[model samples]
Target: MKLESHQFIRYFEPEQAAQISQIAIIKKFNPREIIFEEGDDSDSLFLVLEGEVEVSKRSGEGNNYVVITSVKSNGYLGELGIIDRKPRSARVVTSQQTVLAKIYYESITEILANTKGDIVLQILSFLSQRLRTVTTDYVNQLAYKEKMTLIGEMVNTIIHDFRSPFTGIQLSSSMLKELYPDQESQEWCDLISMQVQRMLNMAEEVLAFSQGDTTLYCQLIDIAKLLQNFAKLNQVYIDFASVELIVSVEEGLIINADENKINRALQNLLSNAVEALDQSEGKIEIRARRKDQLVEITFSDNGPGIPQEIQDKLFEAFVSYGKQGGIGLGTAIVKTIIDAHDGKIFFESSPSTGTTFYLHFPIAKID
Candidate 1:
């Protein structure tokens, strides 16, 4: 884009615009290049001629920068430097190959000295608009932080309240196992105890996630065994739902992961599948295999697929479709757990067919 065609340049008379254009120095930058750093001596006003730039401010943590906004073609950056000689308050980086017209502080002052138009007011108006936008963003961020803090506190309180009952259940299940030494009875008692432990873990998981942490207690686990145990744990629900769950897991596949969290993630998928089936006769299939150096697992169900409107944001918090009384944190929690394990998750769905969620994890190194 030409400097003459710029809207900012049009704010001045033709003669003044020509004078400003004479002083403007065009510069080009490659993608991912830093144009300026926070705290650098502010000198020039950058008018974007091509591509885009990212504006970011140093985070409170001081180790990283949080992106505040993006300036695309025809937009302008560093307008504040034209008004004052203060240091740059934010960092600017090229989002892609970019071209910018740089007008130095001195050049702007010289142009203002010769200008007859209301150029000073035009610059001030730009600064005022930007300040308003930034202020609104800052306020919204504070409100979000406060809201999340309240949720964290509530989750911690609920977890504490549930701990005692979970303990009682665990003790009862242990006593049952001791009293009934028969294989079948002992199996039921063991399932009960395992379930009590899972409930406690689930409560803690919610608390930890609300506090923005997903601490993994990683261990080498047999993939086949994990899938088998998961199927067993949910056998009652599966039977009740009248769903045929087929598990096709390859043996000798191991992964380094948090067993409880992985189980919770799988349980969430199974729960959603059963709900999709609406207690009707349907099929749920889980398959696992070694794909290169990673273990690929798929959970699929032949129910009405995810709603088309929400497919793009399925993993985002508070996104739900065709569910009653769902707060929509299940898939969000699942993504967080998988990310903590350095794994990947994606899915395919069709209204005519069903939904299939794929999870991939690196194989655990055995020495």
Candidate 2:
């Protein structure tokens, strides 16, 4: 059966449904508003007419909340309270501006007396389905957590083993800088030293990620300088592939971010684009502009767009699709790095138009 605009209307005749609608008060909630909290008295059942809400439960220590599920349009909440007359079991907050039908306990009693439909049975079915979903999510989370823990330990061991060799490289680079004392030679030595440190930082980043954490060393970075350095580093590969790299940036634009991490993110995007082009007549464009209080950066490529199979889960770990030698963690790490900087990252792609990634960062304030 086709669903009516009001889900409750499907349970009763037109006249009764009209009465139910009249009795149910329409309520509006703003983003992040708390409709109810865990342990609160439940006097009404909320049926969502628009937008979304997050349902969460207090952690075992009661210090934080863990999101259980999100309820969107045409879904209902507080059904367990209506059926069992118990206090609310979860906290519900609006994820965006929302409209809900608030059906109070007194109104529910009136509907029960008149309606012949199996409303209670429907509520039971909904609850049963929700339970199964929660159980499955819990199991998956547990397994993934265990896997990450193992990865973290392995990463730590590898970093420890590499510590002596990294120290040797650092010492050798510093010695070369001192011995040469010439402009170009010193620059090369400095570059080698910086890259050696960046390698250690990258290893630590992976370890942190495995432990479900992000650590950043943020500094003011010149956007144009960063783009120039990126192009210089990849010039050899770009020339070999016969690809054109165009960079445009607003003068004096600056961003407060972890420079190494952001550079790594750009590298990942470039890698994907290069592999997609497969050394053909490809063009990649990098641009940065200031918008309000944010700095927006775009990386676009004229190549075959991303495959449809992995578009939805592009930012998820291990979601590589239609790529050769892709371990699938690039975009996922990029998202984590951007999120850690309190920035935003997204992409658009199509078969005819190719792919473009957008990154937005909070513009750094200078004294």
Each model's C-alpha lDDT?
Answer: 0.86, 0.82
In model 2, the Cα lDDT at residue 30 comes to 94
Candidate 1 per-residue lDDT, tens place, 34-89, comes to 99999998898899999999988886776576667788888888877777789998
Please give the lDDT score at residue 359 for candidate 2.
96
Q: TM-scores for all candidates?
A: 0.72, 0.80
What ranges in model 2 sit over 4 Å off?
A: 1-4, 8-10, 19-30, 33-43, 57-66, 85-91, 118-138, 210-219, 233-244, 280-282, 291-294, 322-327, 339-342, 362-367
Candidate 2 weakest ten by summed lDDT: 1-10
The most accurate candidate by lDDT is 1
The deviation in Å at residue 336 for candidate 1 is: 1.2
How accurate locally is residue 197 in candidate 1, as Cα lDDT from 0 to 100? Answer: 86
Clashes of each: 0, 0
